[model samples]
Target: MTILITGANRGIGQALAELYQDRGETVIGTHRAPDAGHLRELDVTDPSSHAALAERLGDTSLELLVCNAGVNLDQGQALDDGYPPAMWEDCFAANVTGVFLTIQSFLPHLRRSDAPKIAIIGSQLGSQTIASGGGYIYCASKAAVLNLGRNLAVDLAPEGFAVGVYHPGWVRTDMGGDRADISMQESAQGLAARFTALNPETTGCFETWDGQAHAY
Candidate 1:
């Protein structure tokens, strides 16, 4: 199976890409930084870049498309700063709009696969039932992506594609920090299991890396 992942230069995205590659799958890792070793350069924040990536792939069939590119702009921001208007713009741009654009631009490639699947890296924080505090921008952006993935599942189902939203767990990465609960390997393995089990029967599921259903 051939899989494409965004923001795979580092963090959980990198771990997932490496996991697939080790398992003998064709894994394409896309990154924003040109100097990111073997990862291809593709800025998820740029719509034109998505178009370019699609054109470059040119009808190449994709088995899985993982939208793991996202930003946590409001990390440690002060409430006194009122969430910083510009940060809100950047947060939504990278986290929400970027996911939608990636899915939209890659629809043709997805259609080429007999059993295409989309895995959106969302968060438990995105759940309205679980939400209870700060990081407003990050929370809101994740919520939006969760909603987007759910709706995309509905729209793309007739084409034999399945969409699943997942929380990668609090993995120890740059984004998750050292104090996080799980290691990158653990998250990657659990997520791989989740992805393998995703099918038309469970297309619109919002789940965790460890396989539990999530409230969203």
Candidate 2:
């Protein structure tokens, strides 16, 4: 399977790319940094970058498009910080708008394949049912992604596409911090396994990497 992953220079995205490559799948990893050793430079926030990447990819059909790029700027901020509107805008640009643009740009390539799956990397904090509080910007951005995934699933159903919005849990990555619950390898593997298990029938579901259903 040919898989296209964004934010592939580090964290879960990098791990996912490496794991898929190891499994003998064709992996096209994208990052914004031109110096990324194993990934091609791709700025999802820029339409020109997406157009260039599409041109580079040519006729390579994509079975899966993983929207794994994201950011969290409200990490250590207290509620007293007033949820920096700038940070919220940046987070939305990176986490929500980026996903939409990436999928839109890659839709033609995705349609070329017999099986097309779109996975948006979401977070548990995005779950409104479980949200008692808020990380403010980060939570709201991911929540937007979750909603996007749901609507996209419905919109793309007639075209024979499957969509999954998943939370990888608290993974030990730069963004997840050093005290996270699981290692990047473990989280990537679990997500990969879950992705492999999904079929067209389960298209619009949101779940954890470990197969637990996420509350909408």
- How far residue 134's Cα lies from its native spot in candidate 2, in Å, is 3.7
* Candidate 1 residue-wise lDDT, 1-216, digit = tens: 989999988888989999999999988899886735557778888988888888988868999999999989788878886788899999999999999999998889888889999999999999989857889999999999999999999998988899999999998988889999999989999999999999998999999999999877
- Candidate number with greatest TM-score: 1
List where candidate 2 sits over 4 angstroms from the true fold: 35-37
Model 1 residue-pair collision total: 0
**CA lDDT, candidate 1, residue 9:** 80
Give the per-residue lDDT of model 2 (tens digit) for 74-156. 87788875777788888898899999999999999999998899999998888888675757788888889999999999999
lDDT of each: 0.91, 0.90
Return the TM-score for each candidate structure: 0.97, 0.96
